[model samples]
Target: MKPGSLLARHVAPVPTSRRWLVPMAWFILLLMLSAGMGQLEWLFRLVEPDVREVIYRRAGFFALLGQHVMVVGVASLLAVLLGVGGAIAVTRPAGRDFLPLVSQLASIGQTFPPVAVLALAVPALGFGTLPIVVALLLYGLLPIVRNTLAGIDGIDPDVHEAARGMGMTAGEVLRQVELPLAAPVIIAGIRTSVTVNIATAALGATVGASNLGDPIIAGIVNGNTAYIVQGALLIGLLAITVDSVFERLQPASQA
Candidate 1:
C-alpha cells in the first residue's frame, strides 16, 4: 500500500472534547483563583487596614463603582443617539456633501486625549462628573458613528429599491428593514463604546470625581502597590463581567 493511503486509512477524527479541554481547564482554574483572592478578607485587611471601612461604612467603594457606571452609561447613551442619528442623516442623498466633514469631526474627537478634553472642560464645567461625562462622550462617538455609517451603507441597494417598488414608505423600510439588518453591527459598536468608556472613566478621579480611579491615584501618591493592584483588579473584573454579559446577550447568529 502507498504511504499516503496507509496514513489516511489509519488516521481517526479527533474528538471535540480534546480540542477544548486545555483552554476550558485553564479558564476554570483562573476563575477559582480569582474568586478565592477576592474573598480573602484577611489578606485585604492586612494590605489596607481601612478596606472594610472604605468599602462598607464610608461606602467609598460602592460610590466609586456607581460613579464609574453613571459616567460610562450617560456618555455611551449620548454617543449612541448622536451616532445613529448622524449615520442616518449622512446616508441620505441630501447630506452626502457633509459626510466627510462629519466623519472628520468625529475622528478628531476620538484622537483628542480624554485627559485633555477633561482638562479643557473643567474650567467651563467645574470639578464634578459633568466634565468626565463630556470627555467620555466625545471619546466614545467615533467608533459608534463609523460603525453605524458602515452598517447602514453596507445594506444592499437592491433591497432598498425593492422596498420602494413594493410601495413601502421610506420610514417603514428603514424601521423594518435597515435597522434590523444593521442591529448586530450597531450593537458591536455599542460594546466597543462601553468597554472604552469603562477604562476612560477612570480618568474622572483626576478631576476629583470619585471612581475606581480614586484608589489607583491614591495608591500612586502614597506608593501603595497593594492599593493599586486592588483597584486595577476590581476595574478589570468589572469590565470583563460587563463584556461577558453583553456577549451572552448577543444572538448566536451574530456571534
Candidate 2:
C-alpha cells in the first residue's frame, strides 16, 4: 500500500560509498598492470631458469593484451547473446516446447574440449583467431545458459501472477519485472563465462592466435621459466582484474 513499495521492489540496492568502488578498482588495476609492469620485473624473474634468459620483450605487452581481450570479448558477447537469448526464449510460453532441445545443445560446448574444438575448427577456419574464437564461444556457453535459465525460471510465481492481474502485457512484465529481478543472476553467469574464457583464450596462442599464451607456450617449448612466469603472471593478473570488476558489477542483493 506504500507509495514507493513497487519501485523499491524493483530497484537495485547500492551502497553509496561502494557504488563507484568497482569501476575505480578496475581502472586502477588496469593502470597498474599497464604502467607499473616494469617496476615489477623482479617478480617475473623469481622462477629458476634452466638456462639464463632475458625478460620477455619479444612482443609488446599491451598489444598482446589487447588481442587477448578482443578474442575473449568477442566470444563472450556472442555467448551472452546466444545463451541469454535462448534462455529467454525457452522461458516464454510459446517456446516452452523446445526447452529440452535448447538445454541439450547448450551443454555440448561444455562437454567438448576447447583444444578439440580448435583442432577440428582449424581445418575449416584455418589457423588464426577464428578457430579459437569459435572454441571460446562454445566453451563459454554452458554457464551463461545455465545461469540464465535458473534466474528467469526461479522467479516467484506470485510475481508473474500479480503482473498479469494488473493487466501488464507479457512483454511489459518481462521488461519491467522479470529481467530486472533476474539480472544479477544473469550477470553472475556472464562473470563465470568470461572469467573462464580469459584463461581458455590463452589456448588460442597454441593455434597462432598471438595472445598472452604465446610466452607461456614458448616458455614450455624452450624450457625458460622466466617466460612462463611472465606470461602466467600477466594472465593471472588479468583474471583477477576481470573477476574484481564483475564482483563490483553484481547486483547489490547478490553482492
Candidate 3:
C-alpha cells in the first residue's frame, strides 16, 4: 500500500455512530448508577445485611464521579501532550542527545508507584487535587512516551526518503507521514495510560481529594463492604467505558 493508504487503514469500517455504541451504553449505565445509587439499596443490603447504612452518602455519587473524571482527564491530557511532544523532539536530530535522559526519567516515573509519588507530593503541594493530578501525570507518562518512541522509530526509513523525495517539508513529513502512521501505537499507549490512571485516581481519597476513591477509603475505615463495592463498581465501569472508546479508535489491523 502507498504511505497515504496506510493512514486510511486506521479508520474502522464501522459507521461512526455504530462504532461508539458499546462505549455509549457503558457510559449511560455509569450515569444511571451514579445518579440513582439509592435505588440499589436492596442489592447492597444483601451484600451487607448487618450494616445500618448500605449506601455511601457523605457526598453525592455523581459529584464524586465528576471529580474522579476531572482528575484523570487533566492528568491524562497533560501526559499525552508532554509524552508525544517529547518523543517527537528526541527523535529529531536537534534533540537526539537528550533522548537517553528523557527515557530514563520516564522510566523512573513508571517505576515509582503512584502512592509514593502522592506521599512525596502532598507535603510540597499540600493535600488536595493538585498532588493527585501531578502523581497521575507522572505515572501515566511512561506508557505514552515509550509507545510514541516505539511507533515513530519503527517506521521504515524508506518511507521517510519517499516522502522527502516528493518535496514534503520536514514538518510535513512528521505531520502527514510520521504521525499518521504512528497513530495506532500512540493511541494504544494513551488508552493504557488513561485506564490505569482511572483506577489509580481512587488513591486521591486518602489525600483529601473528594473522588470515587473516597467511598472505598471510607468503606475500609468503617468496615462497610457495600461502600467499597459501590466505589469499585463505578471505577471499573468507567475504565471499561473509556477503554472501549480507545479500542474503537485503534486500527483494526493493529488490534
Candidate 4:
C-alpha cells in the first residue's frame, strides 16, 4: 500500500528456480545442437561456400561431447581430491612444515602449462586419454589448492578456539566448522578449474583422445572454416553451460 512496497514489488530479486533454469536451458540447447548438427549444414555451408563437405561426419557430435565431458570430469575430480586433501593436510599441525613446499609445487604445476605437460606425459604414457587426463589434472591443481589453502587459513582463530571449546573433536571441527565456512571459496576454485579444463580438453584431440576439439583440428588440417566454427561453437556453448551450472551451485556452497 506504501511507496516502499511498490518499489520492492517492482525490483524483486530473481527466484532461485529461475536462477537454475538458465543453466538447464543451456544444457538442453547443447544437447539439441549436438544431436542436430547435421541439420545445420545449410548454415555451415554459408560459412564455407567452397567446401564440398560442411558437416563434420568423421564422428558424431554427441560422442565427441561425451568424450570431452568425460576427460574434463575425470581430471577435475582427481584435482579436487588431491588439491583439497593436500591443502587440508598441510594446514594440520604435523604437516604445517610442508605447506610452503606444497604451495610452491601447485604454483609450478599451473605455471608449467597443460600443453607442456601433455608433451612430457605423452612420451611416457603414449597418448590417448591417460596423458590428456594427467595433463589436465596437473594443470587444474593450482586453483583448487590455492583456494582451499586460502579458505582454511583465512578462518578466524577465535572461531577455531570456540569450536574446540565446545568439545568438538579435531575431525569434527574440520568437518563441521572449517569445511562449511570454506565451501564457497573451495567451490569457486573448482568452478575456475573446471571451466579452464573444458577449454584445455580440446587439446586432447591431438593425442587421439577424440573430443569436441576433433572438428577444430580437422578443420585446421583441411582448411575448412565450417568445421572450425562447429567445434568452436559447441565448445563455447559447453563452457557456458558448465559455468552457469557452477553459478547455480555457488549460492548452495555459500549457504
TM-score of each: 0.78, 0.89, 0.95, 0.93
Residue-level lDDT of model 2, residues 22-129, one tens digit each, is 667765776566566666666655765335554666787788888999999999999999999999999999999999998998899899999999999999999999
TM-score of 2: 0.89
- Cα lDDT for residue 143, candidate 1: 86
Q: Residue 101 error for model 3, in Å? A: 1.0
| Better structure of 1 and 4 per lDDT | 4
Better of 1 and 3 by TM-score: 3
- Which pairs of residues collide in candidate 4? none
Best of the candidates, TM-score: 3
Total backbone collisions, model 1? 0
Candidate 2 residues lying further than 4 Å off, grouped into runs, are: 1-30, 34-46, 252-255
For model 3, the stretches where C-alpha displacement exceeds 4 angstroms are 1-12, 252-255
TM-score of 4: 0.93
Ranking by lDDT: 3, 4, 2, 1
Assess candidate 3 and give its TM-score to the true structure.
0.95
Q: State the C-alpha lDDT per candidate.
A: 0.73, 0.83, 0.93, 0.90
- List the candidates ranked by TM-score, beginning with the highest: 3, 4, 2, 1
For candidate 3, the 10 contiguous residues with the lowest summed lDDT are: 3-12
Indicate the residue-level lDDT of 114 in model 2.
97
Candidate 3 residue lDDT tens string, 1-255: 443444334333667788889999999999999999999999999999999999999999999999999999999999999999999999999999999998999999989999999999999999999999999999999999999999999999988888888777899889888887888999999999999999999999999999999999999999999999999999999999999989988855352
